[model samples]
Target: MQLANKTIVVTGAGGGIGRELCLQLVQRGANVAGVDINLATLDETGRLAGVGRDRFAGFQLDITDGEKVSSLPAEVLAHFGVVDGLINNAGIIQPFKLVNDLSMDAINRVMAVNFYGTLYLTKAFLPHLLERPEAHIANVSSMGGFLPVPGQTVYGAAKAAVKLLTEGLYAELKDTNVKVTVIFPGAIATNIMQNSGLDVPNADAGSDSQFKTLSARQAADQMLAGIEKNQFRVVIGQDARAMDKLYRLNPKYAADLIQKKMRSLLR
Candidate 1:
């Protein structure tokens, strides 16, 4: 979709792929309402955007708050007078642990942000999106969404829901002006680990998976192109692409192999 003059709301706009997507959207002539819970990080994103104030704005929001999420479309419409796109990019991976070891609070928090947050935002914006000739909804799923990554079962489950949700939305929205695209990204060097209060793995000493990591900017670029072409699925990073292919070829074998290979990484 043409981004010029379009108003797009990007959740989790403070870090990683979200931040990169925000900058690229502005560069492509889109007016952006960047939303995140971290006010300081949001400020950094705005500063890095370097676009004039008129072209971009930032808001601090906890995406899981249904009331705030429901109110966002109206607020953005008030600011930009129209809404053309929504990017459900806000997500969290909390307290990496086995399911039995995971606390309910951590699992709930992850589900709230990654699943309900995306659902709330999408439902809130669908009506406004339907008003436009063409609109787009881009959801950030994960490589774990398709295959259970050992360390984060709850996170994988939430993202898996997002993947299905996006696909279902696409099926339902077909023959309409709105488009839905889901992204599965492999490891990108992001602050998600620190933000989740987990030790960031030593990239240099880790397995070859470390070498295959993509930059946040690279993933964001691929996402933009996928949305532009209305692709149903976009896999980012080499690891994600390979895993996706492997799963497509043999789901059970891939799952079992991953379970055996990453048994140690779960901790």
Candidate 2:
């Protein structure tokens, strides 16, 4: 769907891909409701959008709270008068460890933010989206969602759930006015470790790395292009595209390759 003159809601708009998306969407003539748990950073997204309050509004919200998420559509409508799209981008990663070594609390938190949060916001805004003449829903799922990453098992599992959930929505909504797209992004330059409250080695420290990480801006650009084209799935970065091919051709080899390359990061 064309973005011009549309009002779109983007979760996790405080920073990273979400922030970049907010800025780019405004440039395409779309009004944006930037939602995040961090009010300060969410406001910064509006500033970066370089638009007035009429075009960019920031809403501080914790999407994991179902009640609060359910209330967001009304609040956004009150500000923008209509909703044309929803982007489920809010998610967190787990600590680098095997599943048995991770705490139940950590596992649950990852699932809550990555999977359940997406579900809550989608259900809340789907009815409103359906009311529009045309609408779009774009969900961000990681490459780990499709491939196995040794140290991030829970994180991968959560994203995998998001992948299936988004695909199912696409199939069910095919006859409707709403369009759905799921994104598989390779490693992008972001402070996801800091956001998830974990410390990690520098991403570029691995000299033999096979993966090519994209910048946040590049990822955001790809996402917008996918949404505009109404694509069923979008794989960002050369790394993601390569892995998509590998996994489809040989799932076991793809899993082993990622495990071999990423094992050092877990150390």
Candidate 3:
């Protein structure tokens, strides 16, 4: 699971934690195949990585497209000659609304991006990964995946699916060389709201926000640590770590607390 001299494929490489992961993976002496839907931004990630073509390659891909996702393994292998790791990092948040108020289209989009998208890439690359002497698969779930946040109910559900899927993969692959990790990240400073086609309600009220936001780079660093160490799970931020413990200790209290904290975000 050491990153050095490995070929790691990271989705969502256009921005945020995915972009940072690509940069850091190369810094750790690994070649990276960076995937994202945005060509211009994915190219920017390649530029920012500042590595040679052999060290970094940007692939513009929509993970939701099963056909395209299935072909990615061959494409990436043609460039890197091998796939050593797969990090399912691309995801989108739901519009801030209760499930009753949200449209079916909105719910489906979130699931497509967060759950099925990860599933497609995982299924596509898992066989190749199994062939490696050592390989890693890390799926990025959310803190909300394990706890209920009233407004983002469906988003949480999709992430919850990812959480279970990753856990199952870990258990099934326990006897194999392919290591699996499930990543739970707390709030971090990124453009997820805008990317999700919405805006933060209290944009100018960072000081008043209850949760502390970590930098995207910090999140990427911690996420990759799980893979390097071959850990089964990695919780990135204080907010997520605290909630994980609280939810395990008192589910009802944890659920109520998050609902109260998240009320303002709902329409």
Name model 2 segments beyond 4 Å from true.
202-206
The TM-score of predicted model 1 comes to 0.95
After superposition on all C-alphas, the RMSD of every candidate to the true structure, in Å, is 1.7, 1.2, 1.4
What does candidate 3's lDDT look like per residue over 1-267, in tens digits?
899999999999999998999999999999999999999989999999998899999889999999999999999999999999999999999877888899999999999999999999999999999999999999999998999988889999999999999999999999999999999998888888877888777624335656779999999989888789998899989889999999999999999887767766663
Which window of 10 residues has the lowest lDDT sum in candidate 2? Answer: 200-209
Model 2 lDDT per residue over 1-267, tens place: 999999999999999999989999999999999999999999888878887999999999998899999999999999999999999998889987888899999999999999999999999999999999999999999999999988889999999999999999999999999999999998789878888888876653446767667899999999999999999999998888998999999999999888788766767
Residue lDDT tens for model 1, 153-245? 899999999999999999999989999999999888788877666786543323744346778898888898888888888988887888899
Candidate 2 accuracy as lDDT: 0.92
Better of 1 and 2 by TM-score: 2
lDDT scores in order = 0.87, 0.92, 0.92
Better of 1 and 2 by lDDT: 2
Question: Model 3 misses residue 110 by how many Å?
Answer: 0.4
Off by over 4 Å in 3: 203-211
Output candidate 2 Cα RMSD. 1.2
TM-scores for every candidate against the unseen true structure: 0.95, 0.97, 0.97
Worst 10 residues of 3 by lDDT: 202-211
